[model samples]
Target: MKKQSFHIDGAKVTVYLDGPAWDGKPSATLGAFSCKTMQSGTSVLAQAISFVRDQGLNQIIGPMDGDTWHSYRFVTQTDGSPSFLLEPGNTPDALEVFKKAGFTEISGYFSARVPVVKTALTTPTATTDFTIEAWNGTHPEALFDQVFNLSTQAFARNAFFKPITRDDFMAMYMPMVPMLKPELIFFARQPDQTLAGFLFGTPNYAEGPKPTSAILKTYASLSKGAGQHLAHAFHKAAAAEGYETAIHALIHDDNLSAIRSASEGADIFRRYGLFGLKLNG
Candidate 1:
């Protein structure tokens, strides 16, 4: 996981020499990227490319901060809406800069907004073998451990996936414990108490002190219908708590979560893309 940094007239980029592979090819990641102008950005990117090629890598992805667990992707499109809590954002010209540097979209994602009432009404009743329960805010560490385990399993097959240590995962989420609403976070368990799924939702604090929108940040399921059941429970609870809107945040374009968001009448409000460049030997 060696990293090298490059600079060009104030523009800077860091290359992670041991980044996750892209399409089974050796790859590097261009992260910690910044540039004040297109020319500087392009120059810096070219330097990064050269550095990656010298390492015998065939692909490069960015502007990820080493991995997907942190800030990544550029806001390629938007509907004039303000950014949300924990949303990844970049300079307005960042996407164009990447395009001019011979990078193309390697992955696509979007965030959508829907009325809580509509989502709650459209979601089918939970009739699965698993039962959904709200977190009681007790034993917070144990709860996150369950979430970390389920997330690793559920996202194992996702593109550019990488394994993270449990300590790192906890460090990333522990601070948010104070902001979490027990009702909005749920877990699906089998009759024998085996965990099947989990949903982590939070209020849109980026909106204001008392936000009306709830964010469905992340959710995963290992059992059939458990995902939908967890989502349904979240929406119902949000509506009961007087939340008017729900934001389905950062769903991959081809993921089932994206389809579920659309089926619930969510309107696409913002789009993002992870850019990639192919290195020539």
Candidate 2:
């Protein structure tokens, strides 16, 4: 088997595929891990990132093997319970290596799977306080911009936040619009009619076991009560769309807000983690 490898002083490195493609662009990715120390690890990561960038990749997000949305996370502890980022070994440093290489944390997402039998999974609870709505029109660039703005603000508290350039954001979502089924996207609005947050999902209601689409990625504004209320409302939207199980797409352990949101939901599931890096900027 002819395989390619990149090695840095006294270390062996490997690259792995992240996901399917659209119009020849990478859809998602997660770079594999096999580093020894700070120097070698950082070198290996930098080389990998530069390679992805050279490939004409629009935006790169990880602990992931590929893009910004899949298989990417940093483990903080060995307790097997990352409750509160459980103080894991060498994780904090790995990301540090990434940061040194010019990457930034853009947005933090989550994972929650509503069981099929939980018939009430999609219905918002009576105690829910926010107003949940959907974007019903065609290719609302304004709506997507709004989602980017609201989520950017909500995610500002992120330790490694790197403002996603408008171009980058668009490049990531534009391909998924048709695949995302906007009707299933639920937005949480405040009394003032501002987009406080939202949730997006795709239903795999087709006759076969294959997902009706690829993994559905959700974005929302993080605010007071935004976590639970938005989750419930989004759940309602997802069920109405006919999904068998809800998949919370991408997430990070360092993201305090997302971690909190996961707690409020009853059925939260996960996909994968990415390798994260911090940019010198």
Candidate 3:
């Protein structure tokens, strides 16, 4: 535990940044990631935010262990869900602390666990017309680029305060892309090579209480059913391999399309409390 306090010189507030033995990276991973209230450090949050402002970082979004979007969750987990489904430590009171400290909830993302029942979506998924295929080294990485671009389009407006750069994605999530499932990751492309939508999912391997997480994605102009089928493949693989459960993380409440899809999603463990504070310059 490398402890540091900033901004509040003589105040009773302090923030402690802890590094789990598993991580190997920057200060973002070192601090600002905890699910418990007692574990959150006031001084640490204050200092980190100050640093962001000083560095001209106008907007800071988190409960992120680091910048990697897939790394952890901001919500408080329920004991009933498998431990692997847990996210970054969350405390209910932290909401008030951030509020008092001048942070406001810019958005609320939802996470919930659902039983792997039937793919009972009655509406024909949007991806039915296109032919799907597997991705391997032999195939062009550009195909995956198409998938990613389509995903970017689908997720274009979700709580993004500023344009997130590609370099950030490469630094954060792309490092783990090699480990993603080739067969389960689907692509819906037309004969002209236009990407319709993409269903993306992977095996979860992060520091947490759960053995696996099943938060999958369906991003595109295609059928929801196509993604659902692919997701089932992932779930089946996870359970057959002796994994326990999955978590649907970061569902935007304001997005009505997502809400409808998530109506039958999972019983939410908790709503992630996000507060944004603008400093008086």
Candidate 4:
């Protein structure tokens, strides 16, 4: 990872060239990221881009923080709604800075919300060899290890995917264990008692007071219908616990999960984008 900066006329811009290979292959791309401008200054962004190109980087992809494992994307649009926990927050000027600097949207992501009561209580039937269970808070390291293993395979085809270590995965999520409500986390298991799918949810503490809203954070499945089943179970459980709404968070525009969220009656309330700029290297 490399950090670059420039200043002109009291305006300063900081950019991090922290791109790693995508899906584990070497590339000429250097992510133009951690971009902070003292104000909405296109000259600053332009200079930062020029610095990366001068270093012989061919393409710059970001608003990405090195990769998807860390924070990325600019909040491109919203239905004028309140932000949720962990959602990307960016100013309108940030969008303008990227656009003025010749960046184009390379990927799109969105978050949706639905009334918990609107989600049907019908549970998805597991195939003959699989069963479903709740994730009780126990041996978190072991649990995350299982999740990390499955995530590697399940999310292998996702955009910008790279293999992250189990330790990194745990470090990213373990601190949230105390806030995890058991009913909101689930696992789909094969007859051998191995996990085939998982769903993770948390109460929306971003609201400051005790939150009645919930966020469906992350899920992955190796089999068909497992994801839907997990969603059904969690939405039902959340509603039963008096959660007024459920937010399906940060789904890629091309992901099948978008269809599932809509089928469950969720409304797209927020959109985020990651942009790419082709430098004249």
Candidate 5:
């Protein structure tokens, strides 16, 4: 991947060429797109387009910081709800800027929310070979190592997935350690003590003055029903913690996780987009 930048009349934009796409494909992306753009101030957009052409890239995806590992989508639809933690915040003008620059929606994502009480009765079928436990801040490194291993396989087929070293993975989560609530994170283990799944949750730090909500950040499984088992256990634990609302953060429209969120009575309150443009157009 190659990184390039531009400064057009004091407006700066950054672009990446041949980077990983959501589906682990390679594509060019325009990002770090910042400017007080108006109808007359669209030079920045034109410059970005020029950069894509100069790179000999046939297509360009945008607003992606670099990859899915960081921030990527634009908030294409919203119910006027306040943003949640890790949620992308896009301005109205930013959306128009991309649209005017010949970009089209290439992918869609949504975040949903459900009341903890609604999922209180959610229970996955019992699996005799697997056991579930809460993450209690015990030997976090070891736990993370196990999670990284499972994730390497579980998310290998996921969009924009890039193989990362164990150290890099731990480093990413280490900063969030202070905000972690043990009850909200769970792990599923097999009879042989192999880690099979994990569910990560966090307090809704984005909810107004005080966060009455929590976010189901991410979860992965190496066994059947393990994901559901972890979610059920995590939701019950969140309810016990007095959290009224639970957010299913950023589910792809066609992803199975979205169905699970819907089954739990969650409603899609926010939608996001990853835009793309063909250089020839």
Candidate 6:
């Protein structure tokens, strides 16, 4: 993707020319966005808009680094909780910076927390179509390859979805292997040994060395009921491991995952959004 950076006053933003489509039209994405003052933010955004329009694109989205595979969205609301590991964060004025630049919320997401014991007790028993297994902490590379494949298939239809190379996906996750708790990551497999789903959870390392909460970072399913079964297995394992809470991280508002979180008694503690701006020709 071709990228250009724009700066105004103390603010800076990067414009990615070959961004994912918006409403079926080509879009330019703004990333690495930062600004101390609204005036500077607006000015820099104007420069980005002009540059994109000159390239024959009229739609823009940000503050995604490039696509959904990377960090994106601004924290729009919070309940005073501290951020978790790998959570995307921005300056206090980040949301307003985009709003003042004529950007509107194009997508919404949330993070929720639930009691591990409660979720474990309430989750339905596993379906017979798939059996859940935990990662054995061996051959970490192979583990992520399976995850990357399942993720690409499961999230293919998601909004702003973009395919990432397996190497890029592995590079993004391999470093976290040391922090992973084998019991918290699960794989759902069919009778023929085909992988149907996976759940990757980690301890809230940001909460310090001995954390009480587990973060359900991500999970995806290709078969019916596999996702729910994997989640059930994760919660049971987390509770057994003495984790008191589970954080369902970065769930899209309309996704079944969000509904599952709520049904498991998770309460929304934070909200996030992606912003978009439409330029006039």
TM-score for each candidate, following the candidate numbering: 0.95, 0.54, 0.62, 0.88, 0.91, 0.96
- lDDT for each residue of candidate 4 in 1-281, tens digit (9 for 90 to 100): 46766666645555666564543433223233333553536666677777777766657776765567777788888988888888778767777777877788978999999999888455566467667788777898788888889998998878776567777888888897787888889998988898889999988989876897999999999988888888888898899888999999999998888988888778999999888776553
lDDT, residue 231, model 3: 52
Q: Pick the candidate with the highest TM-score.
A: 6
- Order the numbered candidates by TM-score, best leading: 6, 1, 5, 4, 3, 2
Superposed on all Cα atoms, model 4 deviates from the true structure by an RMSD in Å of 2.9
Candidate 3 stretches greater than 4 Å from native: 1-40, 47-73, 76-86, 90-96, 120-129, 134-144, 164-168, 205-213, 217-246
lDDT of 6 at 176: 82
Question: Each candidate: RMSD to true structure?
Answer: 1.5, 10.7, 7.9, 2.9, 2.3, 1.3
Residues 1-281, candidate 6, lDDT per residue (tens digit)?
A: 69999988789999999888888777889999988887888788888888988999889999888889888999999998999999999887767878887899999999999999998987566467988899998999888888888899999888888778888888888988898889899999999998999999999999999999999998999998888888888889999999999999999999999888988889999999999999887
User: Per-residue lDDT for 273 in model 3?
Assistant: 52
Distance from true location, Cα of 156 in model 3, Å: 2.8
Ordered from best to worst lDDT, the candidate numbers read 6, 1, 5, 4, 2, 3
Candidate 5 ranges beyond 4 A from true positions: 9-11, 21-25, 39-41, 208-210
Looking at model 3, residue 112 earns an lDDT score of 60
- Those runs of model 6 whose alpha carbons end farther than 4 Å from true positions after fitting are none
The lDDT leader among the candidates is 6
Q: Could you tell me how far off, in angstroms, the CA of residue 54 lies in candidate 4 after the best superposition?
A: 2.9
The positional error of residue 94 in candidate 1, measured at the CA in angstroms, is 1.5
Query: How high is the lDDT of residue 60 in model 6?
Result: 93
Off by over 4 Å in 4: 1-40
lDDT of 3 by residue, 1-281 (tens): 23433433322222223322111222222234322343344555666666655654354444444333444334533554433322555455554445555666655666666654422223344443665655554443465556556656665444432234555655555565665666546565666767765656555555344434555543344544445444555455445555555455555677543554466556677566554445556
lDDT-superior candidate, 1 or 5 = 1
In order, the Cα lDDT scores of the candidates are: 0.89, 0.52, 0.49, 0.77, 0.81, 0.89
Model 2, residue 88: what's the lDDT?
17
